[model samples]
Target: MKTDSTDDPRTDVQTASDPCQTNRDHVEYVGMHVDDRPVVLNLTEHERLAPDRSLDLIRQSRPGFEWGDTGSGSAQLACGLLLDYTDDEAVASQHYIQFRDDVVSQLECSGPANCWHLTGDDIEAALASVTGHEALTPDGGTPTPSLPVNWSAVNRSERTVFQRRDIDHYVVLGEGTEEWLLLLCAQGDRAYPAPLDIRTVPIEEDPAPAVRELVAESNDLVEPEENA
Candidate 1:
């Protein structure tokens, strides 16, 4: 799956490959982070389709458009968020709540800009909050699930899996409030540091109301669906 980023308003989509077609599919991802944690938000069109060659045409028009500052990198762009915890559950909880709510709201409501997926530990706590469930970890903190609990959102199909492995940015931020260490995820493996530019977003002070609503609605929705 190939993703394209818009200049002003960002959008996110997940496209799969098409066997009958001879082109690669295109999708967009917009990721937001509070402090370091990230949330796995909306994924559009999670089906295998033919790739749009227009993306390539846009680049060909501009000279050196495909190159980064180094002038010798692929056009692919990836993003990630990192959080620093004193190993304090309370602090981690605070960061997790805000990050989770932001992602959930984005998922429920259509975002005007593209939304990115949260792929690291900071957002894990938030996912736990939304699902109203907890995972047991041997270490003091909860364990990060190897895969996302929400199947449809994460694993759309084999086509999505192929793109997730092929091209994606993994960015890691530092531990401080506004600092982020950069990381990269290539070809479906875990993320590591990358030479790409890192973008750090500020964390919110208190996200109590958003957290409450997310948990309440999630719990309310899941019960009937499960029972039904």
Candidate 2:
């Protein structure tokens, strides 16, 4: 399973190696995290499907999307993703959908992005989990994702992730009032320091400590190295 690092919009039909054409519930979705909260993201995956490509393979969603002046280093890019949420109380549902088609699927991130399968169904599930479930705090657009959950937190049984692993970005769903969180399936790079490999379900599962810790250490997470 070859995975591109440049996170952007990408969609394709079933692959040749896929055993079942109808759905991936058996092999694709290996485990599940469930919650009864407002913006729940019950992410699941087939342990074997996580792709095996590196960061450079990722293609930009558009022209400018591919490059980086102060990019997330191959390491930072491959490091944990910031689990940010949307703050728009009155945000349109379409925005979250676009987030799926655009960033989560596009802009490449290593850790979280590597493990997720951002299909159309996953996008809808993410949206339906949130929306009008919590109070809206107008923090502008998506809230800053503070959680730096290790991108690679699964048994590498020599199996690729369900979706083509060539894709770089991961699924990051959001809801109105900016209630959202990133997911965890199994998935990173190197210049930024390696994050602690903490395992938790996507924010949808609502692990208070993990979320709080991510928020606590959010400031220390990777960013493009600064130039002098």
Candidate 3:
């Protein structure tokens, strides 16, 4: 999930609007609620100077099952893991224990947890880096975009760096005994607004490769615009 990269409340300049309107707006926060749970689209990055083997262990132990597979134990495990990581579940399974051990170890070494929260600037950077389609801030985040994020449709849209519209993927966060364990969604596995369902699963075989493929494909979706 992406982190809230917008202006910190401390630094935001207050404008004279109907304070009542502002107050009312406050109740309508800029996020989505999936299954009655608030889901924010923020990105964060985590780093360790030294490779943590435990993280690798947890990642490896994670079942590489796809979501929506009712007959597979791996699928169930994947769903459970997601719930564990998201703090949706009160008690984690053995797999969660192993996963938590890795996270706790990493946090102990690093001050706080951080992961890449893609912002408009990051999208711009990605567009410039990629070569075709335009990068978009479906929802604005860090370094608030000064301009609108949409672009005119052009020839060869498929070759762009980022594509317009929704995404699809299943995510695995833990191992459990039932279907409730997975994080099911149709949006990209990495972020929310990615719909929530109970049949979420890990990408088949290895999610890492699928994830990498998505990243690369994202680049391809919005490659540089052709010369006018």
Taking all chains together, each candidate's TM-score versus the true structure is 0.20, 0.20, 0.17
- Give per-residue CA lDDT, model 1, range 26-91, as digits (tens): 222233332322323223333311112222322211221111121111111111111221324343
Q: Which rank order by lDDT, best down to worst?
A: 3, 1, 2
Question: For model 2, what is the C-alpha lDDT against the true structure?
Answer: 0.27
Q: How many collisions per candidate?
A: 26, 37, 39
lDDT winner between 1 and 3, please give it: 3
RMSD in angstroms, all models?
22.7, 21.4, 20.6
Model with the higher TM-score, candidate 2 or 3:
2
lDDT for residue 11 in candidate 3, whole number 0-100: 15
Q: Model 2: per-residue lDDT, tens digit, 26-133?
A: 222211111211111212332221111211232111111111222322112111111112222233322333233333434322232122234435434555654324
- Model 3, 1-228: lDDT tens digits are 533535322112122331111232121111123233322222121121111222333333333322222323232333233342333342232233322222211221111111111233423333243323222222222221221222221223222121222233323233344322333334544565363433333322322223234434443554533431
Model 1 spans with C-alpha error above 4 angstroms: 1-96, 99-143, 146-171, 185-193, 205-228
Predictions in order: lDDT: 0.28, 0.27, 0.28
